[model samples]
Target: MKEKITYQDAGVDVKTGYEAVKKMKKYVEATKTPGVLSELGSFGGLFQLDLKGYKQPILVSGTDGVGTKLKIAFMMEKHNTVGIDLVAMCANDVLCQGARPLFFLDYIGTGKLDSNQAAQIVEGVAKGCKEANCALIGGETAEMPGFYEKGEYDLAGFCVGIVDKDQIITGKDIQPGDVLMGLPSSGLHSNGFSLVRKLFFEKEKIKVEQYLKELGDTLGNILLTPTRIYVKVILDLLERFSIKGLAHITGGGFIENIPRILPEGCRAYIDTDSFPIPSIFTLIEQLGRLEKKDLYHTFNMGIGMIIVVDPKEVDPITKFLENKGEEVYEIGKVGRGEKGVEL
Candidate 1:
């Protein structure tokens, strides 16, 4: 008799996938709010937009992945923090347009699903959604046996938000005499990890668990630090301040991201010494022998989100943010120049 074929034999376990989803339900329920109308296992996530306060409600959506930082997560066998990075990458982007994040969805694909690991990863995502005050409506967990290595996986996130048409903070209004206020990052905030892996794992052969005096933390812990979610803080500032432009510093670093929100004939003159950079960056620079330009172009360099406001509002805004338990930095000012960032 011919051997019977099964989905499990092909490396896909419907049972395990269902179990993983089952494990994620509690985390999903933790992010529920008034607008969430769909349950965790629904065919589609339903979020009834609550626009009672807005004259013109505009939807803002952003999608992003953790990028090569997932590699670090895999290397350390730490699946938790990368999910937070996934949500942070998307949530922060939508907030740039002055939107209040409403709901979020996630995607996780792996060669073979480990129910426990998948649950841990989704736990992080739910935590991040809670931090952003967004609902974790629904998401996908795919187990494709041959696509990814047995122990490897990839993650991504999508976030939707709503903003009033009149309140959109496009960079068009950014002009000279505007102050650039920076919110400190928790750490790397999930970018530029390809180079990081090359330096630490490929070239130096440093073990992920190795402890360093300068870092005061294990290499794995520092590298796996969860990305910061700025939705609550930024939303609070929006209510009280006239923010001209907002920039979520991600992969492009200062050189690339700052220019995105600069209007024509406007330039960002950044003072490198305006704030203290986390020691992780300095250690990377010293160990990798990377140049200053490369460092600023690749990583957050300790500054995660940049807020542009009128110069006169700088003191009050800084004080407001500081009072809210945020580390605020007057990193730079908008100037009339060639429409680029100058460090």
Candidate 2:
């Protein structure tokens, strides 16, 4: 028989993946909060939910992945911020229901794990958890030599949150005349990179490292920028007021995610002129030839987290987030319509 080269022989590394887990344990522990019951290597994450503070306690869970945006991270070889993206993708979703994240777990699978690369990934996850005030309880790192091409990896995150049953914000209270407020986004938060890649690399004929004033970095760097985690800011406001709805702008942007939280007869009309969208979106739209509609449907367009509140509460909510250094804007208003978002 001719000599055979196995999958491992094709440069898929195994031990390196486990080593990455070992390397990131410290940073993971740094993000631990009150609910964590087990350490990183456990088969299952353990969390204890305390109901002492409320008459009825409810558990909330959300799961999400980094999508093809990982391709951008891979192309750029920048692995630090996506962990935050993974955390935000899930934690922010739970926040939409007005829950406080209690703990988070993640799954990372790769063709081969370079200890250094895996460490960077978990380090990012841990950093995100700490920023959102959730416990980094546990996670898994899988090394399947044949499953992925060498140097390719994927991330999926799971999170659990807690809220008093009566306090959950499910948009049930939304009505006409409720104000729509916007919190600006840092950049593209883990979605639409497939289109972004096509625009910058395939269509625009640009290199990843080419600098642009709008992005303030190489194309790859801008694409790899981390998703912003809005858990802390909104959770803070949850304590002081009753919010009608919360929408975390993600893959569907305002056009889709916003509608999910709107009541059956209520719709959101966003004012495109309200907030100053970052230069990156303008650059992409002008250079990539993307339509204004598709741009709002695909990307956050600089507004990441949207807070919908009753008209009476708008001033307090605005002043509260503003005091916290948030750039808040009166972006739109809720009105009676078929369930949808309008610009």
TM-score of each: 0.98, 0.94
Give the alpha carbon lDDT tens digit for every residue of 70-138 in model 1.
887788888877878889999999999999999999999899999989999999999999999999999
lDDT per residue (tens digit) for residues 1-343 in model 2:
9999865687555566567777989888899777678887888888877778877888899999999988878877888888989999999999999899999989999877788888898889998998788988988888876798778899998999989898888988889999998888988888888888788888888888889877778777777778889988898888898788999999988898998888789888888999998888998899888888899999999999999988888899888878888888899999888989888
TM-score attained by model 2: 0.94
Q: Name the 10 consecutive residues with the lowest summed lDDT in model 2.
A: 10-19
* C-alpha positional error of residue 302 in candidate 2 after TM-score superposition, expressed in Å: 0.7
lDDT (C-alpha, whole model) for all candidates? 0.91, 0.87
Q: After superposition, how far is residue 337 of candidate 1 from its true place, in Å?
A: 1.9
Off by over 4 Å in 2: 1-14
